[model samples]
Target: MKSLKNHISLIIALFTVLASVQIYVAVDRTIAAYETRLKDDYSVIVVSNKAFVPSEFKSMSSMIERSEPISTAQVLDRLKGEMSQKNLDLLRLTLPKFYRIYLNRYPSPKEINNLQRLLQRNPAIERVEGFAQTHDTIYKLMLLFKNVVQVFSIAIAAVTSLLILKEMRLWQFQHAERMSIMALFGAPVWLRSAVLFRLAIVDAIIATIILCLAFYVIDYYGFLITQLKAVGISVQLFNFVNDSLRSLGIALGISVALTFMIVIFPNEED
Candidate 1:
């Protein structure tokens, strides 16, 4: 029962670390997905005194993914009822050309300003609207969310590492007599510590398996999917193969490192 308790404690500690890592990964992916959606929906409007080819603006800024001329049909339709046909025809002839510009990705505030300035350098261009104020607010909010998640994950991992170390020390104490006897017989450190390595590696594998299964169940039930959809974003919560391998690596690394630390710094009794 004592051995079982030690194993369980170590497993739980490793599980906590792995869980925190996976949570951080999911949040990062979700934020990236949301940012992509924002980029797809955002655009800049440019007004010009004369018609211009969309390709011509691409040379000004490589950020320009593409551009399309904005039709004046809706404005013209609204004015048709208020103006005479001759007046409407005259209005169409005098209207400025407008183009909607799309970017390869969401731009930072400085990039937006630079792009605007480049566009305005053309004497024919009258107005450039990139909605800098609104974009800055959304960008800052996203950055804050990402930073918060990162800090929280690091805190959890740090705390769990200490817990894992404490548990490993307990394991070392339990086997101290055997390790001491082996040391007196001139057994190498690795040979004396084989049992600790075996126990830690076993618990690490068990913790990794448990973590992967829990995430699998969560993904299967659509809980993560439903929550993301509620926020108007879609993210894949688990990639079983890749995530499993990563979690296993993290679990083993933490367990082995802590166990080695205990072995290298033997207690006075040992």
Candidate 2:
């Protein structure tokens, strides 16, 4: 019974680390999707004395998805009754050409600045407005959110890893006398430490199974899905096949690596 309890405890610890990692992955994907949606609604306004073709900005073509000219008729409509037809004609002739530039994706602040500089370098462009203030605020908020998740995931993984390490040490101590006896015989180090390797592998598999089921339940019926829906960010909470394989790989890799380290470097008491 005590041995079973230890196994369960180790599995739970491993689950904590794996779940944290998977949660971070989901949050990152969701944020990236949200940023794409934001990009569709965001655009830069450019004013030029001469009309610009979409190809004029070809130097930065990778950053720019397309350019849309803002019609001068809209401005004329606003000042319709305020001016005579002759004055309107003169105003239209003097009014600068306006364009709205759309990007392929939301760019970082540095990228925005570089794009603005590139646009300004064009001889025809008089001014370019990238809405830097609003863009910076939103970008900073996204960075803060992602950083918080990263830090939280790291902390959880670190603490749980220590717990798993402690549990492994306890298991090693429990079988230390047997290992010593085997060592005194002709048994190799690998044979003497076979039990620890087996325990680590078994616990890693059990933890991965629990993690897969927990995420599956969360994906279908949890508040996380509802919350993301409310915010209009649609993303899969977990990818069953891909995520399961990744979690299993990470769990097995960490467990086996740690077990090997402990087995190879025994304490003075052992």
Candidate 3:
């Protein structure tokens, strides 16, 4: 019963580490999807004295994905009631051309400033509006979110790693007498450590399986998807096949590495 309890504790520790890693992956991907959606909805407005084709804006900066000219008809409609035909025609001639420029992706504040400068450098452009205040707020919020997740993941990984090491150390102490007897019989180091390695490998596998199933059920049920959709962001919660394999590799690798370290470092009495 004690052995079973130890095994369960070790498995839970490994699962915690793996789950933290997978959550980081999911959050990273979701943020990327959110950025894509933001890029589609966000745009800059440029007022130019001369009309420009969409292709012309592309050359201004690689960040500029596309450009759309705002029709003059809407401006003319607003002035129609306030002016005669001759005055309206003159007003139209005086008004600068307006365009909405889209970016390929959401950019950092520095990139936004750079793009604004690049647009303003054009002699034909009278004004460029990049919505700096709103963009900065959103950008800062996204960065804060990502950093918080990263710090949280690192903290969890660090604590869980120590727990894992402690668990393996206990396992080593439990088997110390048998290991010592094997050493006295001139058994090879690998032969002496075989049991420890087997135990680590099996527990790692079990932990990986549990973690994979938990993610699969979460993904299959659309629990995360529903929440993301509520906020206008759509992203897959996890990739079942690839993430499962990755989690397995990480769990087994950490387990075997820790076990090997314990095997190599003998106790002071030994």
lDDT of each: 0.90, 0.88, 0.89
Question: What's the distance in Å from true for residue 6, model 2?
Answer: 0.6
| Alpha carbon lDDT at 13, candidate 2 | 89
lDDT of 2 by residue, 32-115 (tens): 877877788788899999977888765455889988899889779889899998999999999999999999998887888898
Superior candidate under TM-score, 1 versus 2: 1
Candidate 1 local lDDT, 136-210, one digit each (tens): 787689788888988988999999999988888887888888988998999999999999999999999999999
Model 3 Cα shift for residue 99 (angstroms) = 1.1
Indicate the residue-level lDDT of 126 in model 1.
99
Model 3 C-alpha lDDT per residue in residues 175-249, reported as the tens digit of each score: 988988998999999998899999999999999999999998999998889998998888987898899999999
Per model, state how many residue pairs clash. Answer: 0, 0, 0
Ranking by TM-score: 3, 1, 2
Query: Lowest-lDDT window of 10 residues in candidate 1?
Result: 131-140
Report clash pairs, candidate 1.
Answer: none
TM-score of each: 0.94, 0.92, 0.95
Where does the lowest 10-residue lDDT sum fall in candidate 3?
131-140
> Which residue pairs collide, candidate 3?
none
